[model samples]
Target chain A: MPTADHATGSYPRTARTTPTRAAQRASWDRERVHGILDDGYLCHLGFVRDGAAVVLPTLYARVGERLYVHGSTGSYPLRTASGAPQGLPVCVTVTHVDGLVLARSAFHHSVNYRSVVVHGTARQVTDPAEKAAALDAIVDQAIPGRSADCRPANGKEAAATAVLAIELTEVSAKFRTGGPNDEPEDRELPHWSGVLPVSVSTGAPVAAPDLAAGVALPSYLTAQRSTNA
Target chain B: MPTADHATGSYPRTARTTPTRAAQRASWDRERVHGILDDGYLCHLGFVRDGAAVVLPTLYARVGERLYVHGSTGSYPLRTASGAPQGLPVCVTVTHVDGLVLARSAFHHSVNYRSVVVHGTARQVTDPAEKAAALDAIVDQAIPGRSADCRPANGKEAAATAVLAIELTEVSAKFRTGGPNDEPEDRELPHWSGVLPVSVSTGAPVAAPDLAAGVALPSYLTAQRSTNA
Candidate 1:
């Protein structure tokens, strides 16, 4: 677990101090922060639209206690949220794969995953430097070394993209890892009861068809690989 | 992918025939259903709470074209939506992990994942038989063989759980898989590149401490040692 004090000035004003049953798994320590953010690349953002609850899947990156999410400027919720009076009250979640739980019974079976959920108001990041940094975080989050691979966003392209900054306050992380937790009586059943570990590994990079012939794969690209946490 | 046909009489009435650009993906088909659902065990269920958007994480199961989700009757939104005047509108989403793309350039870096989003109104399932079946489906979804392992829910237990069923209608699935697609010129950068495949697998079973000394593990539990999809 990462130390809570590290949050210091980076902590959002609304960060929750009292932990609840759902949030009892682990404190939002630094390790927890990086673990949840680095392991998972996607997040589900929940917000209100037209008096209804809407959850949308989007890409996100975590920098310290702040999370950055970008989407097309034309997205309704993003557009509306950027200009909303109270900003957008949003719930953002990230999850990482750890293992699978093959319990003795279907009801007992579950997946092993690490997830973090943050509740906060998301405001559009307008400062050019901030926006650039957030974009880099988002980019580095997906592909660690790819930030320098492509051309930087031009002013027009940057203008067309909407970036939302959400301080990681009032956050909770819950994780279910390790093997199956089977009921006692069913232990003697005739079946194979061991774990079959599932893992993700990088394969050889495939160059884009449009790439020039002489371009060689970057060391960052070739060195990128998965590691067991 | 499972067929869009519904086993129960209930079907989506206002499903869109064609998915928009936002909802559309490079890979769109029924065959991708199980893979997407299996990859993501948790989903964000959106519902209106006091005219505000409330999205929460919940466990779900996919049985054929139907997705089953349930929670305690004491939960706020579930309780409220069950008795609401017109039922609550909801959007459910599930996503799977493929790999992490560590690109040299931030803009070009990205993650590869498979996701499915279902948009529809959630109608309270009042039919006792259907509710029970839905619960079974939920359990089966978590663990394929566990449905038969544990005792069926008694009437009291059944009453305590609120289950909602949604047909896989008005559904859209999107996926981005494979290594990073970096730009041409940055290929020679010293940074490493390539995909880090991510996956979830089952581990050894852990029995609850309160169980009797010699309880045997059920075959259903034991057989679930590997990833199903």
Candidate 2:
């Protein structure tokens, strides 16, 4: 797959992309931004509705610099997409808390995380080929190589879903790692401080109660268990 | 501790609180809402700024129906809080992805999750006593029994932080569980179908490289390892 930024290899910094705090942790590297977005399957999507800000948790997939997200046609955000000119202004963010940073002082405690924020207008995908490809990408993103094994959405099901494509125009990724930054004066304080590493891990696969008699668990899922370590 | 609504024990539903899709997954039960909020440490806070929507990922604490979030005074959303009347109109959401449901058909694949959305006006918390307690709640929410073990924030540190408290007025919890609901005809397709359970797991704690000679890991930290199972 082509990278998010094919030419310059880095995204231009915008006013909104700049980090105000811990500016050292922010990056506008296109590859880094794509990496963070690809690592997580879920994102919090924020958009304006009736002049009110609403944030919804949803699944998304990125193909190059374009992000695809879908929902039922009956959903309010999707319903409003057709009426909005050009597209609906939206902010999408993906975050993974890597660890809990413990410090001698409560004020200094923080979490180690990697996050990507994208600001762009999302327009409802209308082209049938693009919609179908986006849907497949979305499914395969959740489980690698799963799309080929499953049946693609039929015409009726395709009409029931609304997919939005947001081009990544302004994007930034921020990350923090390593140990706590405690004050020098508090160095003598007898407090246990460290990092408790955290991750989203997968457990054993639970077959459906009505799974066919002889079908075996796919190697893709068994492969995930090893990588999960 | 007083519950959010001790008498009614439920949040009133409005058009915004209602789910347009998968309506059966929506619940207005206050306890359910509180449970979802308490289980997560991070939240996406959405608020309008300069006629645009801004969503930020931040740490939050839930004390009864009141959600407390804090950030640097210089932060954009924190700065906007003081200007909005009564408080800043905000939407706070917490979500936990429990499992990935792989279906025989790509369109039927989904995720099991529990999410809570609260819409309300957030007022700047100024009372020193309330602010102190909320800070403790926020820290302890990350690790139970942690606040008493660490040094409390000093005056200088406290002054730099801005806390906003939002009353949980319009709240709703949505959940999806069970195996994938594949079409009856696709049930016999030669494809793997089931759920891959996912969870936030903690690895062994890594003590700071510059830790004091004899400072031991607290029992609370040790206890977490067992519960993390």
Candidate 3:
């Protein structure tokens, strides 16, 4: 029994997007997908190399339905996308573990989490206008108003970077919340059973050793102190 | 210039273990490798399916040089691991992002993170003694002192779970810390430059809806609220 995403159109579930376990928790809603992507700045990128799979941690940003990831032009995987007739097939995933569900039975122990998985063929972004725009979105994703605060890339810097665009066509988000699901027989066990909520918090800002004088922490960064990001 | 692990002989760096960028931040020390692995409970498992790479988010537990991951016997990837003579070729990576580096120049903006990548052949754990130990370690990884509190898996439940062990023979840890590395010319820009430290914290515990009477929150869980998990 999948729940409907009343806020936005649902992405059609495909063979790859279907959930294997806890089917009820899976969602294909566009708004739910975008919300998960927006809350996280890092992603795990999976790609094939020499017939074996390699997973790398990379920073990514979402703009509308397109996700952008940039790397050094010399990187091997980025080179694989440049001349391919069919784009490189990739899987991008973002996960946030919300809490730990401690159950009386070890078999039922689980974690509360929200995750979005995007499967698609990614291609190199060549258009200058789109590439620059994608870069800005990447910066803004990290800091809400960062792109405007930083200096734009110069010609030399732009030429040295490679950006890939992956359209959010086949996407699915899965989430689990609430307390432990201990079995009926194990309910009276002496063990403690509950949910320990987990969150990512931003600590105090540390200025750069070489930061120029008279430049203090901006209001935007200060505001982050109170937020969960 | 890689640092030596004074206690254990450092894993020799091969072309595959070396980083393409920021080579100075890469370490092959065994202690460093274990530190990063012990700090994170989740990992991204990458494997090839139908000639395309797929990455799945999974829970992982590390015991010495061996890492364990388990799934249902009916899962697609678990089936692939059981029958193969040479086992499944996979990459397991765990990452912890410590901070966001906001620089005056977009090119220098980066994240402070610690990550470990392990590449090897993962084989199904068939030994009953090792299997039981691995399962306990998996539970303890998510919550310290948890395995002792929960009921051990019954014969029926144990039969349904499949665990894989990957040797940590080829591993590398990479990290970036401190403030942003803006170019010298961009230092005087009005944009604020600093490091926003990030950490995972546990919130107040929520008891199960059907929790039996008189099962108070244990000291172990209460202690978690004060620590950054």
CAPRI-style class, candidate 3: medium
Can you rank all candidates by lDDT, best first?
2, 3, 1
Q: Write the per-residue lDDT of candidate 3 for residues A129-201, one digit (tens) a residue.
A: 9988888888888778888888889989888878888988888998888888788889899888889888888
Model 2 misplacement above 4 A: A1-6, A225-229, B1-5, B225-229
lDDT of 3 by residue, B12-110 (tens): 677768888778889998888888888878898988877888788888899987999867676667788998978999989899888889989887888
Local distance difference test values of all predictions, in order: 0.64, 0.85, 0.83
DockQ order of candidates, top first: 2, 3, 1
lDDT by residue for model 1 (B43-144), tens: 878775555455566778787777777765766656666888676678787766565665545555556677777776676677989888887777666556
lDDT of 1 by residue, A1-229 (tens): 1236554622322323223333445455556666777765568888876665667778888887688987667776578777886788887876655554555444445556676777778888889899988887787676665666556776876887778988766676667665666657666554334333444445566654444456677766567465332
Kindly indicate the candidate among 1 and 3 with the higher lDDT: 3
**Model 3 TM-score?**
0.94
Pairs with steric clashes in candidate 2? none
Better of 1 and 3 by TM-score: 3
